[model samples]
Target chain A: MTLSSISSLTLRKTPRISDAEFADLRGFIYDVTGIDIPERRQYLLENRLGARLAELNLKSFAEYSSYLRRSPSKDKELVYLCEKITTNETSFFRDSKQLDVFRDFVLKDVLESLQQDGRKELNIWSAGCSSGEEPYTLGIMLHEMLRMSIIGWRIRISANDISTAMLNKAKDGVYNQYSFKTTPQEMIEKYFTKEPGGFKIHPKVQRLVSFAALNLNDRMALKRVPKSQIIFCRNVIIYFDEEMKKKVINAFYDNLLPGGYLILGHSESIHKFSRVFKPIIKPGGMFYRKEG
Target chain B: MVLAKDIKGADGGVFLAAGTALDDAAIASIAALGAPFAYIKPNPAFTSPEKDLQRIESFVRYYFQYVDPDSPLFNELFRLVMERVFEASQKGWAIPCEYERQAKSVEHLHDLFFRDQGASLDLVKHETSLSSFPDTYFKIKELLDSPASTAADMAKVVSADVSLAAKLLRLVNSPFFGVAGRVDSISHAIALVGVSELATLALGISAIKFFKDIPPELMDMETFWKHSLRCAVFGKCVASLLPGLTSERFFTAGLLHDAGRLVMFKNLPYASVQAMLYARSSGAPLLEAEREILGFDHTEVAGLLLEEWNFPAELRSIIAYHHDPLLSPAPRDAAVIQLADILACGVEISSTGMYSLPGMTQEAWNLLGLKTYDIDKLIRLHDKYFQELTSVFF
Candidate 1:
């Protein structure tokens, strides 16, 4: 397979498609990573992956797909595909209603009881922390609350994403004022420092969060984070097929501590997954909790 | 480095950390640092809103006293106040103290506008020509608008400017026109050029000559002309789609919309550059960012220029609010100008054209009644027109 072959694949038809080529490509993606892409998405597949073909100087989709199959260097191709197709259109404190629910009901009740016990430490994970805004937002809220109350709480926020590129950016802890759009001006002036090129979270806020790359499909890799007090795996599982979603939710249930909170995106629910977790409806948000 | 500490609060409103107060005299020493926002935020000693205003005033006074004495910062600040005070002045409210400082700065800027003749001439030369052609433009517009006006009458109006008359002849004779014979006189040229093309060409020639004195920067001779010509070409292209909008008027509006930016560049170079840089870095659309960075945008500045120079009210309105077409009570001219500017900006020009403006507000788009596809098609049309014009102009 050559670069010219892939170039022809992009414009092979107007609003272009060749069903056989698309099927082979879909199967290739599924086989390479066990992620099934629907066949009707020929336009979606072609438009997104076509740019990669050009950049890699590959001529045809055939060669590109085969490159994923034949090369032992599949990691590079997998990373490229994930980064290209993933809709990382996340914003700070996205789905505000969900966060409010978590803050008021779940955190207030669960963590307050835990605080009375010996376990005062809180571990929260924002899985798929696209470009760092979500987890950083979580960190900011937690850091400010803990500092004001003098809680002496040991808080660790771990952010994980499948895209290494996005994880690196998350670790940078710099965002323009836009991401903090909903945040009040006084908060921005106080919590964030004007860094050399952009704004930075102060070291106190920075010390609380960590970023790592992880794939949700790997159940074994998911277990390494231990029992989390709250896991915000929002806006992630909706992309997966039913079986994948069930498997990921089961893994999340197993990973959370007893009475721990599992936050899904406003639209997502775990009802179909299993009987192990019960959905809790707070005033303004919803989350799944381990049923004891 | 200034320190930023979190004010411990449940609601996430932060303030300066305890024991982290900034010395006012010390800040007064280094207020002119490259980034002043840092120094301003973390100094709890400068806590109150009034104190912040005082700090800004001291910063400005010392910024002038110690730093660049003739800096345009004062003028820029003053212009901001005038715009605010103007609205307040209308309501019979006494100007705020901050506004008084701004008023004084504006007065200084006004003095500078005249005292700096070199700058003023650069500005004047870039507007309508000091020559007789401006008078000719009004006469020609009147002739074109009148139902009974003839090409001979149009030719008589333009013939008053010998240079314009000659250019009209040259245009009519150009191979692009496909005329078998040469145009001999103004009447022949106007007849051949057609009323629409004649008006477009006359405006173009007048604008080209007006910009002769100003030296170039991001907007040089080539850039200004290219942008103007592109707008003219795009205006014609887009106006072709709408009913009742004459293509020539669209072209005229396109060429004229950014004429205010040119005026500012000539008279207020520092303010203009700062505005341009802020827009580029922040990805705010040029006009909105200009309003923030310089207190007034090119559209407003151009409106003033057009009014002071006695341009038609329609043209002035078109220039003043091209970015916000819905603001215009009259949609035809404003819509034409708005669409033209968008098409011109969206089409990729040489040197990587302006960054994408943040999308227009939904209300504004709904008011214009244009969908995404209309904008896309308009951009594509302008891209085609720009290619055609580039080959001819370059």
Candidate 2:
């Protein structure tokens, strides 16, 4: 079928999920996932997640939402659906000012401490690493700053996602040079081994990260993860309603060691949720530390 | 199959005008005769995406066929694509794809003429291996951008690079800038050459560095260096003879006038030299020989090479059409260089050095707005100063 025909058929067959129905589905997603779906933001839900409905061969948003709830065969599909609907825009050394601060303070402090303790390893976690971009970015920065190969460091990174599709991409560490728009050529050349069409992180960087499916709402899965020195749950908790945000923050507080770091996107803050973490403001960006 | 030196015969190879197949017999015959050049009708069936590719190919064929071997069309296709590549580069677009396309087409054409018969077509893969200076250049820019770095500090930065220092020293000691006495160290050379001259010289050296890996055959590296130096000497002499022209920049232009020849010879060595030899033996102009041999001439190559080096567009035009001064968009420093090249050749030959390129007297006479006697005076002045110029560099 022609592209236009397919689009038109899609538009016609679905009785334009009513405003109330759209609201209810958003509410259901937020209730199950603890992701806050803001009121009157059905347009965003429709534009970004509408493709998932079509992919499932569901005639309307209602059927897709119901399938998400009740289908026994939907576990794999649900994971993929979460991944498909999620945003994955990121690159190496993104937000240069923030990176500058990390380079000056955080990385310097970590390395100096490591030198003192005679410990070479450092662990970093990028929770909700959509399409692997954030963790890969982390890998690139760490690889560049460290200069020495990660093989000797025993540096292990844990990247978890609610979406299976994104997890798969993260595990398969292939990326085009385009994904490196913000990255310097020298960085790309140094960190990435040239693949035929693009570049791949060296196996050392790739082996540093482990990808797994995780639902943060499930407390059991949270317990399995080891304490992290640094947690980057950037832009993830912005979707969580206030109460859910508090719960997630509490989990992060329990998960991080004393004086361990927590980073959030520019739009997010943990101050209102709980007083467990204190802010460390630097020239380029901000970070928080778990209170003693 | 012929060593380049031995195949200096008259230019009477096949022209495979429209409709003839580029088959074994035709290719073999063309290869065997080795007349330095032959024209082949661009396969009409193959549509050129650039629309100008065939036109460029045809221009190369015609440039050498009719124009001097050193004319700009000998490697027209290579020159045009190179020009576009450099232009795109200035706009911050690496555009490796377009560069690769040009590299492939030029390599394919070079193979047709150079590779042994029945050799695998894949023998020469296209390379986008042109050295990129984006990062290093940015570093230099950062150094320059610091408000704290004084002009002397900046001059020291230029002086720090041994190559740039050597070139500047050579220019200051050159008769054009050598006021009346010899200028010795980098500081003295900077003072004598002036910041403008040093800036131009640094840029020129960077441009030359870009073509460092170009093969030996397309251009004689030592000879090219000598040619540029000679052209500068002649240009300096001519500019001194004139009033109000930037005499130093004129020498700079002369030093860089035939950069196109370097580009062609380096990348399209077989085609470039084939055109050169054909032009030499046939006594047709160098541009004509280059066109017939490789489908583009020296001026075009120089222009393209300059553009690739990110030299000013005006300078690129000057180099592109140096040999044919009348076709220049505006009067170029190349007119100065052309006059200088021809005058240097005349002086070099008169001083018992063997030379085989176009004559300088005619072009120099036009550009200098001087009579034959005046031309005679300039040549003598170059002959006298050439030794002094050589002493500085040595």
Candidate 3:
């Protein structure tokens, strides 16, 4: 019941990666993505990659390495691997741990609902997706999940930021290693081309998003924004007072398709702002869904 | 009372079925059958195997009781450890065969171990068998102490025991030692493994030979060695995996990590039983329970014994802090043993006297700089190596 014992519970029986496994993963990650995972952060690599192995049904990191190299969907899996190790670490994959919940729980259900409908169209609104990180991350993740099959579907991410300066940066799509601290070594290599100024985002990820300056306080503009099944208005909402929080939350709830999801910052909770949305909790954080 | 499970007799015939009610005749026959205990239904107080499992879940929960499980890092870690413990418990690794809580009270335990103050380990010097390590250990100790002694002199002492010499040669040449070229002689093995390191390992192997007198009722000696040898193998593997570590010292440290428990089990059977019971019922860790009762736990006891046996100061300190590795003078060395011991318990490789898994320090995990996947690989490796080494060792 004491504090120390409680913390120790989770740390107990953590699986370990061997020196060789660390070296192999580091080398493999470097070979593919050009980002160098240092030796000290070896624990981080294992923790992130361990989840992938469970999903892939592989036994060891070495096997995960092999899967990345030669699996039939190796290219697709590599994109995911890049997302996994780098996304959370990078501005490109901003709040993508929440994306895990989106991918596994929310998005699949949404895709299924779309499949059942006569038309194949998916809409995502990245409200306040500053410098285009959230939208670009979602684009990259979607790119892998659909296996480059975005041609058949009307997929669009309506990315809006209130600042023109930030919007221009998002459109420019140039980033540095500082923006990519959360990105895996391989992801930086795969999704970006290094330039004299900084790393350049691939046109493929950039093409999925269209950024425009839209203020949340402007009801006319909020109404004009596209209807979507998913909305990511993360840290931006925290700055608003309670009145604004409720109003903006209600706006998002109305803006979505019934049962649409709103992914938030890891620390933000929707319950205090509005009780309309049902929260779906997962590790690292929770996101909300508009209830029927 | 109705029987909740089948009561099989010595001949493997079912003497009573699940629904059988105990009358005078049935009670007489059950008493004559010499069954240790039986399940009685609708008695909420009686702990079923299922209840034992629940206790393990709660004990493990208490063991991990420090962190808010709401955080992502701990949430993931706690979930994985629970999964492992549950699997191990289901497979008969973590849970002991069901028994009623012991009747001995804390006051009774106080009377038995009260004389043995925690700080004064010299209290155990009177224990003749435990106090006296094997002659082979003392022989190497003599050489290790004497500056006049050469590596050949140490090798000659080990060679004097033909059985010890053969096991040493085979072990060095085996993949266990990772020695290059064939080591056919004790002198050559000593030169490769280091004289003191070889002596430490021999002392460990010989210490196992020394401590066979523990009663089955007090502790199962086989299970004790299984845990010890598992720690030994695991510790050796972990040491070699990390940089700038000598693997032999780790193996020896693992073997003797819980030496104090053996001493306690042998010398204070009543008090040790009480400590185990208190640890179980109160949900406190065994070391804490021991400190509460005897003022010190087995690690302290092991430290004293190792010091008396002239174990290297580093090795003595490593054993002393196996449970809390970060406190050790050489934290990494102690962390090596702690990691191995924690692994041994988590997999239910073998249960030490505590019969419950010990909680580990995050500092120890961090000190090793190993990833969780590495631990998974190590446990698999432990399984492969455990069976092979037990045969050579026991």
Candidate No. with top TM-score: 3
- Candidate 2 displacement at residue B382 in angstroms: 70
Question: Worst 10-residue stretch by lDDT in candidate 3 chain B?
Answer: B103-112
lDDT of 3 at A133: 78
User: RMSD to native for every prediction?
Assistant: 21.2, 23.6, 24.9
Clashes per model (N, Cα, C within 3 A): 11, 31, 29
Candidate 2 chain B lDDT trough over 10 residues, lowest sum: B98-107
- Candidate that beats the other on TM-score, 1 or 3, i.e. the better one: 3
Docking class of 3: incorrect
Docking class of 1: incorrect
lDDT of 3 by residue, A1-292 (tens): 2123333444423245778988987787655544445454455456555667788888887787788888998867765665454322126654445566678888888988887885688899998776787888888778777875667788889998665666788899998645664566677777889777788889988888889977676677899888999998765654354666677788898899988999875435556457888877654346788887
Positional deviation of residue A208's Cα in model 3 after best superposition, in angstroms: 86
Question: Stretches of candidate 2 above 4 Å error?
Answer: A1-13, A47-55, A118-120, A149-152, B1-394
Local accuracy of candidate 2 as per-residue lDDT tens digits, B65-125:
2222232211222233233333343444422221121111111123222311211111122
Q: Score the docking of each candidate (DockQ).
A: 0.01, 0.01, 0.04
Q: Write the per-residue lDDT of candidate 1 for residues A75-116, one digit (tens) a residue.
A: 877877876544565557655555766788887776688778
Native contact share for candidate 1? 0.00
Off by over 4 Å in 1: A1-18, A28-36, A148-151, A273-275, B1-394
TM-score order of candidates, top first = 3, 1, 2
